[model samples]
Target: MQSAQQASVPQSDADRLRARAVWLYYAEGCTQSEIAGQLGINRVMVVRLLADARRRNEVRITIAAPLGDLAGMERALETRYGIGRVILAPFADPAGDPTKVIAAAAGNFISSGMKSGMTVGVGWGRTLYNALPFITGATLQDFRVVSLLGGIAAARRFNPAEFAWQFAELFQGEGFLIPAPAVVDSPETKHALLERCGLAAIFEMAGQLDMALVSCGGISQITTSYRTGHITESDRRSLVETGAVGDVLYNFIDAQGRPVEHEVNARAISVQLDQLRRTPERVLISGGREKHVALRAAILTLSPTVLISDEQSAKALLAEG
Candidate 1:
């Protein structure tokens, strides 16, 4: 008879390859690229093998190091920012993209703290969307998800409405999406939609959220907002000129975390910054050196009860103060 590990995996070459990949990832701490190089395969194949292993219940996440190892850094961030709590993911290399690790840490946080009968207001971004796969889903009664911002015409995977809907589906709960553009052509048009298009009800729901999960975006380049064609290059230049560092829920804000005086801010449709602050549990999940200024602004603006980020970003945040 075959061993338990062998029995779980098939006898095919592919299965054996996948098993090896799992060992490299979980046991040896080899990255996908390293595993691929060792196994004489492409990185994509290594990724697929690892993913398959995870699906086959062969992946067990054992915490080799405790989070307390970085307690000092975490505590310093919490004290300085006046955040209720701070969780940091280990990022050995400052040059590497820390989005995945930060998202994983945030996923663990949400999975552990989420309870039934809660209304959650959600913000959209690559980091937040990446957290979806890591969240532990359960069918809960009276659970609801509110998209804090309006949806875009483009059906991107990270669309605000898509994230809200998918998150709700995970819990088998109700999802409320604002059926309008995130940024309307004019403030008058924005008001008309909220008043006459029955979108006011969605914002009304957002007002009473038990928790708000949000992320910030920097104005350094063409990010999601610009990618969606809602913001032009001219707009970006103008925003930079106005001292805008980044945006929270599409609300362009300056370094001080105050909404910048811009036409974009006036026409954007989303929960007001002040109202978002009122949420009983406001969680901010974002990181990376590019967002250092924006993250600081978000903390100042939202006063988030919880902050999930990477080690390098946390250090930068502390050093800047």
Candidate 2:
């Protein structure tokens, strides 16, 4: 009888080559050329072996981000707010600006949650604009993006229309924009536009959104609304007099999340706060000291299903409760 090693068939040669290639390439971090030389095989053959290994389920890759601190905070926020999901991004410099950090993490969360057939509603702000670069590009079918709010008068990087269009472009999807001013001259004009001037269709689309990505603007002087001149000095004083802490989609809200009585809220051309709450998945992405009050107000009002925020913001939010 032949020995066990001698009894093995010639097919084992290919298996051995594939295993060695995977080990050298992955474990030892060797270049394909180096692997080929070590195995005394052509580079093309080495590449094929590695491909075969992957196809055969012999190679597996995993990325484990150190998220212990984040996970704990996420759990705490979820438990406190009854939120469906919470993602806390780590920031090394607690005192540094949290826009980039929060945006990158929010982008990753949005991209991962996206599906082939889904309608996403987008809101405009610097945080949402900063998230554009971190989104992974893909082409999906039946993917639609709708701008939840109307456009600003001037051309700007973070306009509602621009953000919606760019987000749709990332997935090669369709974008439906509310082709009207963010704040009309009066409530009657806003009503006329929505009921008769083509904006009704956008509101109908908003009703069918699978998810919504939104941010809050604080009442502080440095807020996007203030900086962009959308909220004037008179408007600020009026809003403050009514106990407004911040706004979501230009609908100013108090600390308890009740919409403040303001003229701007009536003339605003955006989805109603009540409608936003009904969206299947509402994600609130914001951070920084300026935003903490706004974020809290948004949470009480929107009851967001998901929240993507920085470590400092998360801590402040939890402490508030």
| Cα lDDT of model 2 by residue, 1-321, tens digit | 223432452667867867888899878989778998998877656645654554355664432445546888899999898899998888656577889778888878876888889999999898998786566556678899999998887756678887887787667688899999888888999999988899998899999989999999888664464235456778888998999988899999999999998898999999999999999999999988888898999999999999999999998989984
Error of 1 at 267 (Å): 0.9
lDDT score of residue 76 within candidate 1: 96
Clashing residue pairs in candidate 1 are: none
Candidate 2 lDDT trough over 10 residues, lowest sum:
1-10
Considering every candidate listed, which one attains the maximal lDDT? 1
lDDT of 2 at 45: 65
Candidate 2 positional error at 6, Å: 60
